[model samples]
Target: MTTQTPAVRLRGITKSFGSNLVVEPLDLEIGRNEFFSILGPSGCGKTTLMRMITGFETPTGGSVELDGKTVDRVSTRERDLNMLFQSYALFPHLSVYENVAFELRVRKTAKAELDTRVREALALVRMEEFAARKPAELSGGQRQRVALARAVVGRPAVVLLDEPLGALDQKLRKEMQFELKRLQREVGITFIYVTHDQEEALTMSDRIAVMSRGRVLQVASPIEIYDAPTSRFVAGFIGSCNLIDAVVESGRVVVPGLGAVPATLPDGTADGARVVVAVRPERMTLSDQPIEGGFAGVIAERVFLGDEWTYHVKAGETELTVRVPSGETSTALAGLPEGGRVWAAWPAAAGRVLPADETASPLIGSPA
Candidate 1:
């Protein structure tokens, strides 16, 4: 755990299965004590990359360095790492304390030192009182804590988690999100978490590496990843974004169906080349009166969300959703009903333009 070099580094790493490439040559540097996550959809090779880091899978090309030393030839067991599977993988017969202490016993640590470490690990996850309970008798969250305790008890240099919260219910999963973050800070160990859940990645990690098609798309903090996705794939996959097809005319983006809207374009974008503008629902506002720099639409439907009222509006053939504060719904809509004319507006900073195609469809059905 003590090192000046990165905890893990993958330089020009590539892996293939026969003719199909699972992971393209990619370079990544993970800092010491950094809670990093590798996120992507199924078949995107997130798991394969994590396996290579833990020494469970060999790279067909390139190499993996741990603490500045190449460990591509090392065995999984010999690496100073611990991995918690999606399945808790706890021993049913062993008590939580025994499960946490099992690793110490394997290395023949002293009895006094083993007990002290086990208790500390259990307390770190707030599961010290349930130390005597077996995995079968504990709740999902409790069992998850036990698994975490077991992984951290041996003080591994890095802990790899493969969707540890995927097994829990929605409420329990949300609760465990904070719990895991707290545990990471308390133990001060580097955590490399892999998951396809976007919300989970945004909620827990210090930084996220968004991947697709076996390549890393963008690596940044949660805010940057969501606000400034490097490509169309990252924008659409990370969260809910209203992607409108547009084209760059001069320097501004001219959306065909919705007219020209201010947007940021990448360098060397052709004047008539097709592009897309991504706008989040939360960034939009609905009103009856004309506002500065806002698009006009017709109200098509309305839904009541707990703290806000969502109005689906049609801008030509495209439909957009706008969320207004619960208290301002009546004033905002001004008695507008289905088919009533209105305006959906937001600042220039709210939208980002990118390369677009048929994939940028509206969440709400477009007006006929």
Candidate 2:
């Protein structure tokens, strides 16, 4: 039996600028047709990693492979990959059709094939009607589509997008997120997306690699990444999580102000081990009435989000944030104003325990 090669592979890849270590040694494999995201804050080396894969920068160690072929010394043009940027680098004077056709022209493709490919690429991005329009005449979203058409017109083996949607407004960015995913599926090619937006990564990625200080911390599906973050940084960075410092005793986590809460100890964790209990804000429930084994607090503040309201409850020294859905629904905590007293409750399975020391914590992965 033969094994299929991954679409892209990085083995022991490391990069440094002079004496400054930009990326730590890392190994990663992206499967065929996968929408993989490298997420992190600025200066976390995600863009540098993308550049390494594009042959724009050479790695200090190890190799980059496309379909199992090492391409450490390959020129950018020779490698089977295409890159799309945030600025949508389209020629100001060229029509969208010519922009998409420029790549094929350079390759000396047959005229018939070039015309067909350009039109097909334009059609794929739903921009065929604007083929004759110059880049200067198009809207930002339209320009983005034109650039996307140009990127995939040559049908490269992999596409590397470096914060491609960063320039768009929030509404347009959200729209393009779905569009980007749809286009990737239709093209059936590997997509390595680099972004610093957490919501953007969560919305579109098949798997996310969360990076911090040049190291990949964790790589997993979006659901798993959100629900099962392995480190304190991952827990705090991925979403709005309540990371309560606590100590484990008798199979429960004892928070400084919130008292004890049920938690499933990770393997090898002792009774007196210091840990942090991570719970998503939305997982916590607030009741106007006191309940058994629940923490009591007064609302510190209330922020009204369109679809939901976030209630910040102050219980002793610990403050817990709860997300309550909007509308006059029975479950909604509508009349609970700031300074209102309430009790917070969550099932035992809601909290995930992690080691207290961040350095003792493990790696995590991602773009935003």
Candidate 3:
């Protein structure tokens, strides 16, 4: 459990094209052997930031660092990094073995050494048997595995993956998530992955840098990013949440639809100040009897989802959804139906009060 120094760093990173400032100046760090992800919606600048890191695109301002040394002057090939693209970028005529060995050959490694490294790389990805097959001969998932094997064969200081699993089927993509994580751990290299897929980032990252409008909103572990988001954007983007308008008073916040939630009011959280209150669906409880520190709502709809049931309820002008245990709760929810009387109760501690101005913000970017 020892901490390691960062393998990569960026400071005041900025990118702009014509009149458009695509990415604002930002700072970031990637720890050695850490599986980090830069995630956001398309056009949010996650890719732009990554391009700067991989040296495919130069930053308009600021510097890029590797192992504490400034690398802005170095070319991509000289930077000790390899990138796997979303397109796979394999040579059409080259067999998988040749494709994986291209870089080794380019460096003029001895034939004997190249054979050993190429075979080891294929074995690392469990694709040694498919070396004779061309890219077109393999399935999309298999081609992706080949690309991964090729990227790691060089033993670069870091690996950058740009939506590497985008073309695979849902089940295969899910399977590859675990596979990629295992590979990253086995190699012990700094892995900087970029994706717009929240689930993918959450599933594979040691820490995620959630970007929006060309800037990072938060950098934290997946669980911390999901459970204790610093902004309304992070709260709504990482998971399902109910954002209610509220007013602060006496160290508590009174939500419009829900009641007062127990919370601390820092010096800036004034009495009567407007704010937004966030509550997760799983944190709430539905009960027949009224409970302390809870709100009441009518059940609007119920949908069974295999192991669990989702109950959608409307309170005032807002709709609230909650997931409960399947069997018995499914029957109870079915009986409740749309517009049926019911109470939605959640612990006061389950809700977080935030500044009202940020409630409408998207999960990826800045404050609303």
Candidate 4:
């Protein structure tokens, strides 16, 4: 197989401001025509990394490369990159056509060529019919489309989106997610997106990099990141997971009041070593029948979440959240009182063992 050069590469990148390190030394490679997302909570340095790539912030150490060329010394305007901001940043006085043509005009392109590119860009974003409308007269979604048109009008090799859909409501944001993914595939350009929304990242990214405390914890596809996370932080941050403290003994994880659950430990894991067992709530099954190899618990609460039912089950001193899909057969359990007794069971392979050291430091930017 042939290896393609990365569209963007960061080598030992580091950023600091007066002894406060916002971005630690890190290396990353983004493939060409890839929709990659940098995901984390606020103040986790995702935005800072985007700024460094866009030449808005200079790294204290290391370099930034694009298409195999070092771009650390290149001015932001000289680099072939475009950025879409959360606020849209459109010109209130200009019409959509003029806004989309702004970049081409600044580059001294001929008027005829500028008009052609502007119309094409607008059409690409499905906003060509609104070309005559000003930014002030358009809705939030329309303004976003105009901003997208302007970013791609110059046909840059890379587009940096820093929470581009943040301003829209939930319904509009969901609609734009599909639009953005389709646009990325059609343009065939590298997209580096930064956002704190986990579901959004999983929905749009070809691959995701989970960052914390200015450091990347893991980089993988959505399924791999969720199903087999590398650390406690990644497991807990990416989705709702039950992280039970356990000890490794006889090749199994021993959970307090839960007995030993079959698990695959990492290579070189020693007997009697402490580890954490991660299990997704949906992977568990709840039943009223007494079953072998199951933990007995009482349903403390139940919540109806449209498509699924969430039950807070208390076993011994630990509380576990279990999710049961909504269906004719499962709906029978809906009437089960909160104090009803139930058993929760899951496949032996559902549990994943992670290094216990991951919990040593509090998550960066977490509330005190």
Query: For candidate 3, what is the TM-score?
Result: 0.93
CA lDDT scores, all candidates in order: 0.85, 0.88, 0.83, 0.87
Q: How many residue pairs clash (N, CA or C atoms closer than 3 angstroms) in each of the candidate models, in the order given?
A: 0, 18, 1, 0
lDDT of 4 by residue, 1-368 (tens): 97988999999999999899999899999999999999999999999999999999999999999989999999999888999999999999999999999988889999989988998898889998899999999999999999998988898889999999999999999999999999999889899999999989999999999999898888889888888788888889988998888898876778888888756666666778788878899998888877688889999998988888898999776688888888732544777899999888777778778877773432222111
Off by over 4 Å in 1: 1-3, 266-268, 332-335, 357-368
For model 3, what is the error of residue 242's alpha carbon versus the real structure, in angstroms, after optimal superposition?
1.4
Clashing pairs in 3: 275-356
- Which stretches of candidate 4 lie above 4 Å from their native place? 328-332, 359-368
Best by lDDT: 2
Per-model TM-score versus the true fold: 0.93, 0.95, 0.93, 0.95
**Model 2, runs deviating above 4 Å:** 327-333, 359-368
Q: How much is the lDDT of residue 2 in candidate 3?
A: 56
Candidate 1 lDDT tens digits, 1-368: 85579999999999999999999899999988989999999999999999999988899999998878899889999998999987999989999999999999999999999999999999999899998888999999899999999999999889999988999999999999999899999899999999999999999999999888788877899998888765678888988778787777887788777777866566566678777788888888778877677777888898887898888888888778787878877664757778888877777778776657433322222110
Ranking 1 against 3 by lDDT, winner: 1
